[model samples]
Target: MLKRLFKLGLIINPYSGIGGALALKGSDGADIRQQALIRGAEKLSGKRMAIALQALLPLKNELSIYTASGEMGEDILSSMGFNHVVVYQHQAQQTESADTKAAALELIAQAVDLILFAGGDGTARNICEVVENHCPVVGVPAGCKIHSGVYAITPKAAGQVVAQVIKGELVSLMSGEVKDIDETEFRAGRVIAKHYGEMLVPEELRYIQAVKMGGKESDELVLSDIAAHVIELMDDEPDTLFVMGSGSTVDSIMQELGLSNTLLGVDLVRGQQLLANDLTAASLLEHCANKPVKIVLTLIGGQGHILGRGNQQLSPELVKMVSKQNILVVATKSKLQSLQGRPLVSDSGDTTLDEMLVGPIPVITGFHDLVLYSVGSM
Candidate 1:
């Protein structure tokens, strides 16, 4: 005989995107937060959450927010003058995955209509373990690498989607995969991704991103041809240093050269030998010091991102070392087709670098085949 107020849950992994601009590759655990900060990585999650929450301010009175204390959620909501209830407490600078899980549990107990989180795939994994379809959830893109389908295309998009839901719009729900990667291996230039599980997510097709699909076995032949083209280019300039960005297409080139490469991390090669196995932004800069270098990358399927998605190791500074003219883009015809006429995108977290990447760039789609495609901010 009682009606509950329309309630929504909020969680913020304050350190989510800290590792990105620092060129840490991925932001998964808490230990890297300090290292990121030391490297001048900004606390992007809070700022991003604020961006998302601002969209809901007009309807603040119609919905109530249940969230964790401090940086987790309360601080942002309070500052925005939104109506929110803190149901969980956490340490200021010591919040861990455990804290995220505990906060999710508390939010679920409060019978919130939906749970919106801010973080990367790892943060999604922690929440997936506790939520498990208990309520609808969404993600605000504020991480280094987001391979999960639950996230909005951008923080502003996330706010719009949540605002629509809070207004009682009839939005469908779907199960979104929670993708996780090994940070140690990732930093080592080896990407090992595993499916943790799935969670209920609000389906706003225009705003939400799809889960990152794995490299298909059928793409091997196409990759091999692409590799051959890159190898020939390398042979002509034996003295030039080639910085390899992660992806199966680029990995195929290393395989063709018979050199070991980090499939999910940056690698460096000089002539026919491997110069560096896996490299961070600092390591990349160190190795390429005073050396003429070129960057080789492949477009991310569906997303059409050539940088700033899963390849933070290729930082703007490193890109400067390589120079845009020396950068090589590789993709198969099918992969390019997946773009659906949209231009390739870049979000390297550096506004100037992203601007430099604007306009048409050549993409190697096959052996001796080049296609000029436009690059824009995502």
Candidate 2:
């Protein structure tokens, strides 16, 4: 249980991940002319609420929650039976980033201990764009391409960890992944993941940890070999959306493909053409709208996160369109060994997307070989 009298702020972007799932061509989509709910948005939002409810339920007697108005904040609390938990005083509608910024600023003004939010990497970037490390921040994943390290493994897990932090449980705070992607290219089957910055953990959250790095260092020769195999696969394929994620490993693939790629950036490749490079969220989605796409990414060695690290451009909204089957993980055997006993930490800032990526998945590093990658919770 959490210690008493912790004032927390809550905010949500009720429509954050809805656009891409609608095939509407962007992550900014909040309305559909078709008059039905977008499944992607609902699922992500539902997961956030569930994890939050479960995590906060045990601490109701001792804590107070201050939240934004309407779908973004109150509904989650209402569903969890939090009538007395003072909702934030709203000055306007709950639809834009301004709303989030306003509410966040208000929360800070009120001296809230921390703010728990649910959104994507863009959302995290928005918060970080305006606010600093004045107060602790946590994320409940409910967006598409999350690359921000503000989120926990699950919404409930986020809540549980926050509770632990409040109780001063000797946890360690690690620098989180601050990444965001271009959603426009994401649609046209292109991806441009960029590192925005890092976030701070409250030091009591055990379920959430920093992305780990290898201690032994890299063997340039092996990376070269793995990169060659991935490029060969790319060359043999028919005209397809080749979404190349970031990192040195992927850069090797681009070199073999004869395409000039951003060394530490996401790039879009389709057959002989280089579609887009170094794009933002809006850019990736615009490209992926109606294309046949294949995602090629290398796993983060020790953290095990294939998409969340240097590739935040693969948002939940984007992932929904790509589906789990479309994702291809490329890593060498040596790399897999490094990740063998760790959880693929996804501080993508969106809890729901991380969950979607959790579990044993195939790691394709060399030709005709795939290893299963498993996620562990500490």
Candidate 3:
């Protein structure tokens, strides 16, 4: 194969998902090497790095690489066969956020065409903090929850997008949702998502930008109207589940059903049984086993996020089992009008999950007209 001029930048946060894996309290803080060691696991940023490597390995000889130094920098590049230029090294606690900041800056300084990174929401925020809009960036989902638009749906999907970009394809660089989740709620077993900002996704990119849920805000949306519509749509099937995700709009549905809701937490109601209320991923998955479920959701206002913030209950794996087609969204017409041109957003923590829910899904508010929010809109 002829070599290509694809210049890429990458980074990894070693201590990301271990906390969830080891029952270590949380995804941040512990300071892995800086604080103390637990059970011989030296805090590996390897997971995220490995994902990015898989995306890039196919075109190793064709691209020039810039990366950070140390476990996050040298180890992955060496193992992947790319001779990368190390820009900065991170301390052990140096999670994806720190490394991403360093690598993005280096790529900007080097004026590389693209910066491909590996991490979740925190890492995405770190890059947004410093990324020059002129430099296009993409993310490889490797962290606990990657709700950033910059990431491809799957790590390998990111590689294919890069392949297209370098092949001189007419790719439109669209902004994907830069979403953040509240670490505070995470420990309490609640999902709380907030919009950090936006990132660019080269157009016609697949597996990177999921179907965006809600976007912007409109003065015209009436919560009551959206609620009424959802109530009418419920099949009222004997065993069919009506899992309402967090947000005011879904709350409207709950209100219509005469059931109390978390307002900002996941709620599950099936045939009026209220199977599980304000469920966490563990709880939802346990109970949802082998059952047909219908998720009645609402997109967050302004930032347009449908998941991630307060609905972490919907894990990427769980979402896959549910199938993308199973999701049902409810947003006020005014909210849809407010979207104007921004795509809906979902940071559900998992990039693949984000992709699954990132595009244009149907939004219901009233009887006749439906609102549409697309990943390309923003």
**Which candidate ranks first by TM-score, i.e. highest?**
1
Which scores higher on TM-score, 1 or 2? 1
lDDT of 1 by residue, 235-324 (tens): 999998999999988988998999988999999898878978888988998888898888999989998899887789998998866766
lDDT of each residue in 1-378, candidate 3, tens digit only = 232345666666555555554554446554632333555544545655576467556667767787777765677788867878877766654445655666667777765657777666777788888883545667777666666677888776776776655543434456677887877687689888888777556645221221224543332345555566566555546576677888877776787678978887888887665666778888887877799877777777777777766777777777777765567777765565466555567776666666545333545655433433453211
The number of the candidate with the highest lDDT is 1
Per-model TM-score on C-alpha atoms: 0.53, 0.49, 0.49
Cα lDDT of model 2 overall? 0.64
* Candidate 1 ranges with C-alpha deviation above 4 Å: 1-4, 205-378
* lDDT of candidates 1 onward, in order: 0.79, 0.64, 0.64
lDDT of 2 at 348: 60
C-alpha root-mean-square deviation, candidate 2 = 17.3
lDDT tens per residue, model 2, 44-121: 564575577676777776567787777767876887877434445556453677777877877766555567888887
Scored against the true structure, residue 128 in model 3 reaches a CA lDDT of 84
What are the clash counts of all predictions, listed in order?
Answer: 0, 36, 29
